[model samples]
Target: MATEHGVHAAHGSAAIANHAHPLDPLSAPEVERAAALCRQRHPSEQLRFVTIALEEPAKAAVAAFRAGGPIERRAAVVAIDRADGRVFEGRVDLAAGAVEAWTHRPGVQPYPILEEFADADRVIRADARWQAALRRRGVTDLDRVQIDPWPAGNFGDPAEEGRRILRGIAYARDADDANGYARPIEGVVAVVDLNAREVIRVVDEGAAPVPAADARYDAAAQPRLRDDLRPLEIAQPEGPSFVIEGHRVRWQRWRMRVSLHPREGLVLHEVAYEDRGRVRPIAHRMGLSEMVVPYGDPSPGQYFKNAFDSGELGLGRSTNALTRGCDCLGEIAYLDGVVAGGDGAARVLPNAICIHEEDFNILWKHTRAAGQTEVRRSRRLVVSSWATVGNYDYGFYWYFYEDASIECEVRLTGIIQPMAVGDGPIPPTAHRVARNVAGPIHQHFFCMRVDADVDGGGNTVYEVDTHPLPPGPDNPHHNAFAPALTPIRSEAESARTVNAATGRHWRIVNPSRLNAVGEPVAYALLPGETVAMMAGEEAAVARRATFARRQLWVTQHAPDELYPAGTYPSMSKGGDGLPAFTAANRPLEDRDIVLWYVIGVNHIVRPEDFPITSVHRAGFALKPWGFFDANPALDVAPPAAACDCPPGECVHGHDGHEGHAHGAAR
Candidate 1:
């Protein structure tokens, strides 16, 4: 795979042409060279690299490069001084072989690396106090204990102040590969100082018996299996519909560039639709900027359980190596992702992103009164990736339809965060999944960043809501209604929520570009299945992730304003990302703006969600409103019959009915 992508690891031996695109993710060679340059700057000190990835070029520079100009490659490096626990942020100019900038950011801690996590596990298990706690619960098999390192969130605890801490959750496993979450060792929490590389404290309140249900979800655990299911195959004999060169993809009327980020797993750049022989821009950049998974239980061990997956753990670093038939299907193309490990070394995650085409049933259809029918099948190009963040797995899929509509779907399926409970009445904060296994209530909030470049950059956003007119002369029959378009003029005003009663949707229109009817060319953003953050404003998570409270937030474009929950959310205090960005309430009229849309999923644990949870989906869609003069898929040709078995010889009719023709006598 490295050979296929020309990603050599000789450290600066590979030319920059191997990563030519301005927005391309850092390759293996580039990551090595960048790390080497950082090491050269601090030759004597030991540095623990947290994140190393492409320092995306400015918007103007990327646009210029797309217009056949040159680009300077750079990498952003975040590391911590192991000796002093000081955080340092640096930028390396790979083109010039120099360290462009290095600054120490005080009052903050970078995300813990994999190496620290592994070391913490060793540090905890070896601790005499932790071993005593396990023995108190009648578990003496040290090898069977699983120490899961979690971010020690800032809760104003004096002992945790100014310390790089990891709160460990203990689980008992039957074997090496068995599901550890099923048997959570309650009333025990291990606090480890990562810099000290030792267990700082071990709290054992009261031990509860671990659940002993048959939680093994693999096929080997099942005694019986379904044998009646038949095989179904997806074949695109001619090949995939999309063409890819470098990291850019072109499918039907869609054109976009794809990149994998250490923080944002899948990023789509310069997303545009080709219309009337001209490629027009829709969004300059699109990605999941931040996500917060906050458990609702207020228990001592569960209250501080909120996790900022992207900012704290990094989605790209946790991305799974997708399988062919399982993760994707039908003439698939895979992209390898390169991310920095704890030592600043390049770690290539093969098949991190999957690209394929899906049959969406139908695009458009019409049946005439004369018994003639015309229909066109719908096919969409899907760009997706999955990440296993601790107990849960998340799949991010971006779909590009031939009709010029875009959709982003997130699928959640994995082991629920389990807790051990006694045979008393279950707590309101949790549901009993097994005999003594309880799953806590939690919410997953995802913030999507869309840098709107709707026809061009000079765009305005309007909240369109359907309102029925008052019963009067204007509505004689009391049935007249119209869409009330409200312009989001200022940053403060742009912070809005979804009003399902009004059928609310936001429209991004380029005021400078007019459609055929002399209206602004626009696209509408339709949200889906959103639930508000149940945490109050005083809650640490609500203050830190203010963007989750509202479904939509519009801010004037700023190069540094990328993440919704600020740069470092590992142990952040609060009020940094959207709240800080929109504090000034800048005017957004006819300006280059970005929309931060939050998609929330409220998970109330169900009995069926146990063993292994099925996929729960939530997403949003972007449809061309006034951007297209008419139906963009009108020119799509109808699908041809697969087999040439003459009319009566085939088992199915042209309309896919068994042993029958359309409009035939029964």
Candidate 2:
């Protein structure tokens, strides 16, 4: 008798057909017997039979496993269809003992039997290797390890599986914490016991956290001082003391403030005052005084121009036009001396001069030019750098003043481009370079300022020099045939011929030349394929300036010396007592100084800057490297208990919020 999909009369006893048949039938007793026989064949095996419904096999299997139990000690035996090889495996100890079977075809046995067996000793052996790998790789925390099962057809030996587990653990452990700390936890090791076929232990071998003073560095040599700079008794304001507008000035830690009439800009007051008490200059370290000059009653043009030229205000008799020129003027107010204010009488003490004319101008000019409306509203820019500590000596470096000033300037320049709204498209060439006359052409301008304090026990710092770009089609001054492409031809062939007309033009063409907007068009530089063009000459110039400044700072300050050189570049602490380029430096301490910078493109005003100018600014602050050594999120661990939210409404609630009432409880 024949029945359903693949059932038919086999022998007279109705045996299930194998291979060619659409369905095969085996009784529940037959399946159980096959399982028992396989277990017997592999005597040291711990096994369980896993049955999955045919229609929704994979999901059902995973759901059962996720309902977790003590399966770590047993091997999973899965039952699957002969046609499609999907297996449902689970922890052996968790599976129910009863066996059941079913067949799609009538007249066939209700269950189909397929037996698979694995040595329990092999799994145990693999777990041991996995544990060893974790120890070798310095993995200590098991709770944080993530496990991903191998695919069905590509199963591996226990050792290999253990390695995969260790790899996953390493990846999960290496992620940066929210506070940017990136160090791996110490002395932690994860181990597996092969014979037991289980993960035996998660060990924590890391050292105890210590305060900065107890760290390896010499703390006694670096004396600690109070943050305040006020003195005890003051003989009424005397000598050539100048009055400043202190109202509305914001007070900052490690910095002092003095106000000047707006019209005075950045000019220094012609007054000299002396302190009247015994003081330790080193105790007032990191304190900087700022003289804020308001733009009092000046013509708008003067105000803007003065702000722009503020970098030219303070060059002592030096006449170097490019390196030492100062055509700007402004009022100066900065922390010059430390004072004690106890004993009912304030007396002046030895002071640390944080700001000086030259260094101030260098910072002022660079920032002013970069952030000016006329320049920033036109270009897109990105700037980033790393810091190191010991360039001069072990002494603290006060480079934050210069960095902060520059950052403030870039903030004023404001170059962020507004994103297009929904359904709006970005211009194809918005980030591309200009081609010929038909497409839009963009021109960029840049100005830089550099200054250093000569009075802070250091010689005149060298002004950073920059490299000029090679003259070519993109270089307006050198490319002889650049003017011919006033209006480009539409046909690609015509443009190519025109571009290659002159042998000299061909020589300089770069065939890879990008359009004005920086997008790559059909050009023949590398094979016949089109590619994006290189950044324009203006960008190259800015890049050179930034690079030169970084190199000069690192070389001059090498982090191992005492009294590290003070410059915008010297702000970060590094290994060997210098600033670091990578994230591996020691943590930043309370007295450490930091420098920050921001730079971007400037526009010289073209039709492209219509409506309002658009500017893109990018820069970062330099702190002592590795300032965050611990896991920043560890302090915020979640509660262990589950929340009490009622079914549907509280599915998203976290564990601790269960019993907490929201709104008015009924």
Candidate 3:
């Protein structure tokens, strides 16, 4: 697979390209070289690399490229100690082939699985303390324990120190079966502190009450199972309707370059559509900024289930190596992703990104004179990727429509986190997503950071609100209404909740720019069905994901302020990331701004979601509010229906010589 993508690492040599494109992720060669340099500087202690990803080029530097300036890409590398939970940083100058900076940091928690697994083995390997805890839970076999690692937050306790922790679960894994979720060790949670690299304590939060049959998550144990159904195929006579030049895609009127990041997964760059004569700009850059899945169960061990998937763990790096024909239908274009592992070796993730064109219902249809209907079928360009974070597999997609509207969607599937269901009735706070397993009712929160450079850099977030008018002279009829748009003038006023029933939408527009009707040219964000976190205001999850509290949050653009939840939010206390970034209440109007839109499902687990849940999606649209001159697809030709003119006699009064030019005989 590495050879296929020209990224094959042979022995001690790196096969990654060292060239730095604006949107390109960190290369293996850059990482390998950077890690070697960092280790040389810190010769005393052993360092294990954790995250080796690109420190994205700033927007200002990116903007300079429009004038044909050189863009330099840098790599941000982080590593942890093999013995103690100490964090270190290494920054590499990719172009100059040098390590730009190195720093030894404290208080930053570690997340590399290798470090935790090593530390956990030291403590829980036939240790008398953990073995006693396991015996109380009725598990006799001490050999089948699977130690799962998680970040240990400081929780703002003045007495507590920062480090990593391991949650020990029972392993029911077999060579042929893939139901690790169903094999949780009931009634015992081993709390090993990696900071101390020893067993500090054990928390005996007994498992959920249910029968033993609930643990059967194997395919053969599935209820209501039936034989495999008939085969279906998606055949394209003309092959795929799109062209993939490297990772750049061109489908219908859409044009964009796609890449996968270690945290953002599928990222679309220089996204635009062909409209009228010229190519117009849509978004300079966009992707899933961050996501948080917080469980609602309030037990001691459960309340801390506010998992920040992207920040805490590299969700983008966890993308599944997508399978062809099964993951998508029709002609698909596969793109490989490259990432550096803890060993500092670049690993090639093949088919991590998928691109295809899909027939999307109706674009526009009209019954013309003589019942001559002009109907155009819409075909959209879809760029998709999926990531599995522990018990959940998340799918992210970017769809570009012919009418220049962009849709960003997320699909949640995969097994729900299981608890040991003992012999008793399940609790009321959780729903049974499976036969006997209970799924704690939780909210899946997603925040997308949109750098909507609508008609260039200077833009304002104009909020349109529809309100009921009073019974005065202004409203002669009782059904009269009034609509107004208030420009978000300051950061303090930028945070807004979803007013779904009121037809509310935030328009990103440049006040100096106007359309044909003298209206401010803009693009509006239509946030679909979503649920914010229900945790208390003072909760750690709520504080970290402050951007999730509202539907639309706009702040002055700062390249460093990328994630809504602050950078390195794994074990952070409250008052960081967006909350701290926006506390200045910076003026928002007529300035470069970044908008964060939170969208997700209000998941109350249904019985059918067990074993593996089907895909349930939530989405939002970036539509041309006043950004376009007119309907971008208006000039698109209608689909060829049964034409009355018939034969080769020019379908809609065009000369049949389109395929040929009839000049002189020459």
lDDT of each: 0.86, 0.21, 0.71
User: In angstroms, what RMSD does candidate 1 have relative to the true structure?
Assistant: 3.9
List the pairs of residues colliding in candidate 3: 210-422
lDDT of candidate 2 at residue 22, scale 0 to 100 = 12
Question: Residue by residue across 327-421, what tens digits does model 1's lDDT show?
Answer: 88777787878898777789988888888899999898776633345668799999999999999999999999999999999999999988888
**TM-score of each predicted structure versus truth:** 0.94, 0.18, 0.89
TM-score order, best first, reads: 1, 3, 2
lDDT of 2: 0.21
User: Worst lDDT window (10 residues) for model 2?
Assistant: 386-395
Candidate 1 weakest ten by summed lDDT:
4-13
Better model by TM-score, 1 or 2? 1
Sorted by lDDT (best first), the order is 1, 3, 2
Give lDDT tens digits, candidate 3, residues 1-666: 222323222121132233235666665566677767767766645577777778878876876865689877788888876655668887877778777888778866635445456767667665786677666655565665555554454356443446465555443333334466655555555567665777766666665432244345556776777779987776655567676555556777777777777766778877777766566666777888888887777655455676778877777678889898779887777777777677677776778888777878889977655445566778888889999887889999988888889899999998876655544576766776544467777889888888777877588998888988888887787898777889999988988988766789888887777888899888999888887668788877777777788888888988778778776777777567788878999999888888889996777877788767888989899999877768878776654333343344323323343333222212
